[model samples]
Target: MQPNFFIILSPAALEDLPATYMTSFFLPREEKRFLNRLLSEFPAITVIEIDAIVEQIQSIVDRVTQAVELVLALVVASGCLVLIASIQASRDARMREHALVRTLGGARSLIRGSLAAEFAVLGAFSGLVAVVGAEVTVALLQSQIFELPANAHPWLWLLGPIVGAGLILAVGLAGTRRLVSSPPILVLRGTQ
Candidate 1:
């Protein structure tokens, strides 16, 4: 027999297909019965090959995943740079605070502890805001643009906040090391 002709039928053509062919795709029960009748009359017609459809879907999924990964990497890198710059700029203020603590008889270790705690709180707050903003954006896009269900995984919420907080904490601590190590008097004099 000749290669099966692929007839791409619209939803309106559902009533014309046989039940056997209709069952291969997602059709209502009523549509399936009507299709069964048509297929019984025409044995030559087969529904589209499922394997080909699956392969096409998989290819699309792979491309989408790659694109998403690339975008995510760029976003993360940008966030890191912004965080580093913000922390670096605030070093002088932090050093002044550290110097005050030292003058008040706080040890260097205690000064470091205070800085870490401040950064941790900042990280947590920033993470919370970022997560909420992202969730709202995704929800809006799904409902308005995609016209699809807005179901986000729990892990997304958890991961975003955790990652954001961790990134902030890591960058803050690393970037402030120089300020933390300087002499308290120099920091207070604004000489460093």
Candidate 2:
């Protein structure tokens, strides 16, 4: 029976053989034609090309990349869902505090703005810490592992805070819209 797989012999090893051998070379697009001609003429020769092997490897890489992207999407979606759930869980306490502020003569818009600003500041601070940690980690990896120069992107530091703040503010407000809009009396009375 024919084996399901075959071991590939290196060119160096094959060249050491003590028998007469024939080699054929073909241009890029003439591989199939040459392969067909050889199969018809010799009936036992095998054909393979560097380009074909490289193409197969590239296809595998593309599949792995697609799988990584799908996993990343799932992780991000789950993180957002967790964030929303946590905010919802804290709604009652947040409403009580907001009610107290309102009862103490704070304007409704002021309370909402303050909460948004607070979340944004927290996000910005967290982003700054994250950037610092990432910079240090990358620096270590580059210098020790890869033996490369450490590169820093100043724009990333600047943009990180803004992006973090904007995202947190948007998500926080979206998740707490009801708590932010309800009047102090209704919130205190637990009527809405």
Candidate 3:
């Protein structure tokens, strides 16, 4: 019986078919000459390659990647700004604690190190919560809305806390630059 529709076959697989009804031609480094001859001989035949289809898929993937990166950058920028504002707002309380530490003869390095460690811990805690929340949300969406199998990314567990701590430390330190530079007495005098 005649086939209902023609199945596209790869050029590489042409050799696998029997030579009775199927005609296989090989023209080394003369694809243009071969195509010209084939079309002239059988102008009604159609030849299609998967390259165009694969290129379309690749283009879609690239666009998705770019959109994801843009979104991630916006989120990180906004998070940093929020972090900076929070730290700056709590500056008075921090200054009082630092002044107390200084009165107790705490060294400059000690105070700075303590602040850095505190911020790092805060960041790690925040990251841990965020990761857990995100994982749960994604799992729910996958199982309920999308009806797909949900999988966890193990790297997120490790990376999230580390990145969070680093970002918090960086932004917190930058926000408290004035407090870091000023003497405790000066800060206590309300002139800072």
The number of the candidate with the highest lDDT is 3
Q: How accurate locally is residue 32 in candidate 1, as Cα lDDT from 0 to 100? A: 57
* Clash count of each predicted structure: 6, 0, 0
The lDDT per prediction is 0.77, 0.80, 0.80
Of 1 and 2, the candidate ranking higher by TM-score? 1
Q: Evaluate model 3: give its TM-score.
A: 0.69
Question: Global lDDT for candidate 1?
Answer: 0.77
Assess candidate 2 and give its lDDT. Answer: 0.80
| Model 1 Cα RMSD, 1 decimal | 9.4
Better of 2 and 3 by TM-score: 3
Residue range with the least summed lDDT across 10 consecutive positions in model 2: 18-27
| Candidate 3 deviation (Cα RMSD) | 7.9
Across residues 52-119, which tens digit of lDDT does each residue of candidate 2 receive? 88899999989998997899569546756777898889888999999999899988898889889888
| Clash pairs, model 1 backbone | 17-35, 18-35, 18-36, 18-39, 19-35, 19-36
In model 2, which runs have C-alpha deviations exceeding 4 angstroms?
A: 1-26, 42-46, 121-165
RMSD of each: 9.4, 7.7, 7.9
Q: Local error of candidate 3 at 135, Å? A: 4.1
lDDT of 1 by residue, 85-183 (tens): 987787778788878887888887887787777777777777778778878888998999999988776777777667767777788788888877888
The TM-score values for the models, in the order shown, are 0.66, 0.64, 0.69
The candidate that wins on TM-score is 3
